[model samples]
Target: MKKTSIETYYELFYRWQRSGLSKAAFADREGISKVSFYAWCKKFETKPDSQDASTGFTRIELAESASQSAVAKISYPSGISVEL
Candidate 1:
């Protein structure tokens, strides 16, 4: 087996997500162990310092509404919208 750098692993992670393949299948195609791939993903995802805008997740805070008629909305990048 050959050694892979963290940067390469990160790139593989990104590509795997875009490929829409299962983790096991992607790892097999990439010549890596699925277990290691999953471990790496968990490590990166849970690393406090790794939180950033690029993770495709954001922390949102909503203010408390005094009235029950308040409306809330969510907008997606694909032009989809949801209201509550």
Candidate 2:
């Protein structure tokens, strides 16, 4: 793998997360190895959103999907730029 700076990693992380590209697909596209991608995914899997109970997505699926959504995207606080 090519050496990447912190900024690049974070940018890659943010992009990979927000792009909704599954780990394998994103890793391939970004020239990142699957192991690294999975590592990042596991490391940052804490963004699950709370879902409405009435959505009928099933409790388990809702939880899983919420967790996946959280992992697949991220929101930064105002004034913070991924370019930094």
Choose the strongest candidate by TM-score.
1
Clash tally for model 2: 1
Worst 10 residues of 1 by lDDT: 47-56
Candidate 2, 1-84: lDDT as tens digits: 566554555567778878988878988998777897676566445434342222423233223553434332333667554421
Candidate 1, residues 1-84: lDDT per residue as tens digits? 788777777778778878989989999998898998998777666755434424645565678889888687899989999998
State TM-scores per candidate: 0.52, 0.44
The residue ranges of model 1 lying beyond 4 angstroms of the native Cα positions read 47-84
What number of backbone clashes does candidate 1 have, counting pairs of residues 3 or more apart or in separate chains?
Answer: 0
Native-referenced Cα lDDT, model 1: 0.78
lDDT of 2: 0.59
